[model samples]
Target: MPSFTLPRAFRAARITRTHKISAAVVASASCAATLALTAAPGNAETTAAQAPAGVKPVSANGLPLTAKDRADDGAKDRQVASSLTAGLKVTAVAKQGHTAKQAADRSADRKIIAAPKAAPNAAPKRYANNLDGWIRQSLAIMKSKGIPGSYQGLHRNIIRESGGNPNAVNNWDINAINGIPSKGLLQVIQPTFNQYRVAGTANKLTDPIANITAAANYAANRYGSIDNVNSAY
Candidate 1:
């Protein structure tokens, strides 16, 4: 093998190049180690702090989320869900209460509508079955039929004509001569009784209430009212 000595400057230059290449290789290995350390799970917080705005630090697998971070996010989600559930429950309860109140009000209204109304008038008044009873009943009927008469006036005329006898007959009177005799408590003839007979009373001329009502009706037409009659017609 032949030995040849290199120039001093070229040897120096080659040594410098070799040194530069080694330095570059060492620097690159150092940079790779630093990046590996930064991406480690323990340096997750540091990586996140150094990350750009709106960007998250990620590990080799995925986002560099710690257990506490996952726990905090889960807690926030649970809190929001719990709040929504509680709000729904409150709304449902309020709606149910309103519906119940409305139903109760409707029930009360129905009860009020269903309740019976008070009677407008009282029962019909009762009367005795005698002369005094007949006079009072006749007056009531006369008032209803618009025939005016007083109890005292009717009693006075009845006493004078038939002596208060309900079955009395006046066959001796001028009315009897014309084949229409005066009969009953008021001594009313058949023709006058038929002409002026009040409704809702007995049809017989001798009936006490019917006879009184009919005679009062006749007297009212001829003398304004039975109360004004002091003498026979």
Candidate 2:
């Protein structure tokens, strides 16, 4: 009366179709995974000059010698620096408990005292050899003080001014109309040097290192970075 269905073979054929579909799905997923792996970005590369993390870079205003070394050497010759007093001393001459007005008179008659006798033992502090070192020192100092990146104009300003030579000295430095007495790689004016306490030991100015150190320091304080020197007046 009714048509009868087939037994195991028909069901087996459907199972084969499902197995093929499952294999195709797995293959598609594997291909997608492969593409993703290929498209991924690579790691960043580091350079030779870059120091490993957490290290303080060198800073000495281009001084070939270290402050510690200077101190150590200075210890042997403390007597000499002490003896050679470039500074002046003032003595208050009080006449056996004088009155207030008498003290005032002494003040009016203030004497410019002379420095004491001192020995000249230490050699002058030396600056670096070339211009590159001078520039690097200036940049390093700026970097240390957390100067902003936009202030990079300083490096360029120095090139225009001193050609990056730390020992660069201007012939006219300040009052010299013919030229200005600018010293070191940055060609800082003598007046500027006096104001900034740029002079250190016997002769750090002519020294390229000292010049760079002082110049960058002055630039940072006055302009917030060398970039100001580079960009505007």
Candidate 3:
């Protein structure tokens, strides 16, 4: 039997087919190696998922980190947590302080509301500047000083002594001869006036209120009361 040699085109086709099959086999082997590498325990994605919570498997430069890096990251996380806890405590304390201040303010407001209001000032009492006014005013003062005299007694004495004259002076009497003339509505002498002069009255001998009060005081001391003096005591 004689061996037949194939054409150049058929030979070239066969070589091309062989080359394609070898390429296919090589690609399949490369794919299988990639699949094995992906399933390995040292894979980046699998390692990252299997790592503990809050731990990063890779660094910022896209490289896998060591155990020291993970520990540093955990320490940073704890530091942040501590700072947050301190912030929360401070906020709570501030809220408590604010609530206490509000309560204090409310208490102060209640006190203000419950406090009594001040009464308005009343107008001052007034009196006329005449003889009747003077007698009434002197009577009020005498009552306060515990001196005893009635309006009728005072009026009768004034009519007899000086006829209601506030500036009367007894110049012809023995009291005048002694150089201590009796003066004023009640005819009181200088020494007696000075001794028995009521407080809050004018110092002048002829001053109506002063003279009346002083003479009435002297009458009360000597005769027990001005109402008992019907003569020139």
The C-alpha TM-scores of every prediction are: 0.49, 0.34, 0.48
| Candidate 2 C-alpha RMSD relative to the actual structure | 45.6
lDDT of 2 by residue, 147-189 (tens): 4433245557667776766555566534456455666555766
Worst 10 residues of 2 by lDDT: 42-51
Query: For candidate 2, what is the TM-score?
Result: 0.34
Model 1 weakest lDDT span, ten residues long? 51-60
Mind giving the per-residue lDDT tens digits that candidate 1 earns over 1-233?
Answer: 99999999999999999999999976675566456556755544554565444444444565556677757766877899999999999999999999999999998888545677778897888899988998998888887888888989899999998999999999887888989899999899898888999888899999999999999999889999878888888
Choose 2 or 3, whichever is better by TM-score: 3
Whole-model lDDT per candidate: 0.84, 0.55, 0.85
Worst lDDT run of 10 residues, candidate 3, spans 49-58
In terms of TM-score, which candidate is strongest?
1
How many clashes in candidate 3?
A: 0
Q: What would the per-residue lDDT of candidate 3 be over residues 124-190, giving only the tens digit for each residue? A: 5566887787788889889999999999888889889999899899999999999999999999999
- Point out where model 2 deviates above 4 Å: 1-129, 145-152, 172-174, 178-180, 197-203, 231-233
Q: Pick the candidate with the highest lDDT.
A: 3
